[model samples]
Target: MHLPEIDRYGRGHSPLHRLDPRLKLPALGVFLLATNLTWKLPLAALFLLVAFLLTLLSRLPTNFVLWHLRAPAALGLILAFLLAIFTPGAPLVGPVTREGANLAATVFFKILASFLYFISMVATAPLFRTIQAARALGAPEKLLALFLFTYRYLFALLDRARNLSLAMQARGFREKTDRRTYELKARLYALLFLRAYEETERVLLAMYARGFSNPRVTLPQPLTSAQVLRGLPLLSLALLLLALNFFW
Candidate 1:
């Protein structure tokens, strides 16, 4: 029912936090692309280091950023493990090879670097504001609206599921490693999905009744010359990394 708080670090006074999302979004995109395109492991490490410095500039707690990377880091490690096993080259140790090691290291750096940049840019801003910025950059309005609504009300949907769970518990339902429990859980999930669909239809009808036909979406403020110029450094960094990717 109530909007959930998403901008946990938005209260900080960092320049990155204050940077216009319109500028920040594009810079983050270019930075992520450049970092991923880098083939050299050393260049990838350098790119990650730069992303870390940007996180520092964001003024979010250093530990918080690292914490955010935990899931991605775990997935990256798994990916690296698979790549090291599957990709063939001069044998290093057992099945692992020199090429695979290089490839794994590159994957690690790219994943960590991209996530760090995202934390610096997105975690420090209001999520809705960033979504708004996406619109300013010519993203599709209908898709954006669908995403924003889905994300915004996700907690409510989860709450509904939880309440259903509690109701089941009140009726003496006990979870166990049994076929019946699995079937019951599946049915519960199906019921939740059906409820979600019904809620969405009701929401659509309400919107139509409330004059949402041809709704006027609010656009972000226009950027000025100074604001546009201020983002040049980030753009330059992206270009510099892209150029480095071509070197020995």
Candidate 2:
């Protein structure tokens, strides 16, 4: 994970970072599940507050979490706009209703809380350990494999695109809003696609030739008392929130 790369912010060694992935994964999972499931705005807000605090505890730079938040914030705004306009209720403002605004706020809080919790998990924890944790928890191997490969190929495709752009620049190519430019850009894209396919095929063949398997990984065997203690605060809070939502 290098700077300017996606997931570059995904490395750190705070206490949360050092917690066993086995314990960490479920605790975050519980928090995420509870945050999304709660319907009350206050509860949702509380969940968001809690997640933000936990993100701070993760000790990754603030930019690490904020950087991942841009897309989700944009999405929440779009949903707010659409829902506040379309969902019918007592009129609150021009086209927006009180009920619609409330619903949108609920969604917004949930989305932001979920994103922060994910950042806390991903920014601090090692990627391989997280995958292994998922595996140990009985996640389907096929889905995990698909996710792993897709994440890896994002870098591959980006590198491929970057190389093509560099090659074009080296050859004195310049963009113009013309048919010639469109045709050349299309050809460049086609070449990149062909290259990707060729690369994939070569990798697949090499895998078959060498008997490819998942990278050898050994998850920590014993969940330590310290790990349990570290995980409990979040897990307990998640359970309490769920109970508040359902039973209070």
Candidate 3:
């Protein structure tokens, strides 16, 4: 990915960004656990409130956060309506009943809450750092390596395709052109696919030459006490939401 795009969405100078990636990830996992396990509307509301507050603290745009949240929210909404309709329950809004309705509402809201929180975490934390954090949290060496390579090369391949497209356009590849643009575009795409495959093979060979398959140990960045101290409040908020669920 371009550094600027990643920096805008994935990393920034904020309390959330400064926290060790490893800690933030696990804290996120725990947040999801509490949200889903409790599966209560009140608990979900509390989690969303805290998540909203964190977005402010992290200095990410609300619109950007909403963009990521929309997809999961849409799916959750569909599932919730289906469950509420089918599950035996007292009538809620419309024809839906309340008995099993509450359970469906709880599950749906929990999923939405968890998705939004995770998206916020991603927006404020660099993907690379998150992967490193996962490694520190004991992700398998092979998986971690695969993650890194995939991350790097995925964007690299996209960049190459974009460049190729530009070159084609510059060479008069357009709808108005007399030549068959569709045929040309297909051949261009096929060539790109071949090139991409060849490039991938070269990369794999280079990795093999470097003994990437062999077990190797590498140190992740050290976490500072100050970083943990900052993250502690976020974790506390997650727990506090769980606690509040009991009173509700």
243: Cα error in model 2, Å: 1.3
Candidate 1 lDDT, 115-189, residue by residue in tens: 988888888788878888899999889888878777867887988988889888998999999999999899899
lDDT of 2 by residue, 1-248 (tens): 22254446556677778776777778778888888788788888998998888888888777756777889999998997898888899999999999999988988999999988887876676676788788878787777778888777877788878888889889999999999899989999899889899999998989878988764434446676877887787677767876777864
Write down the TM-score of every candidate: 0.88, 0.83, 0.74
**In model 1, where do residues sit more than 4 Å from their true spots?**
1-6, 169-177
Which candidate comes out best when scored by lDDT?
A: 1
Q: Whose TM-score is higher: candidate 2's or candidate 3's? A: 2
Model 2 clash pairs are none
Residue 124, model 2: lDDT of 70
Best by TM-score: 1
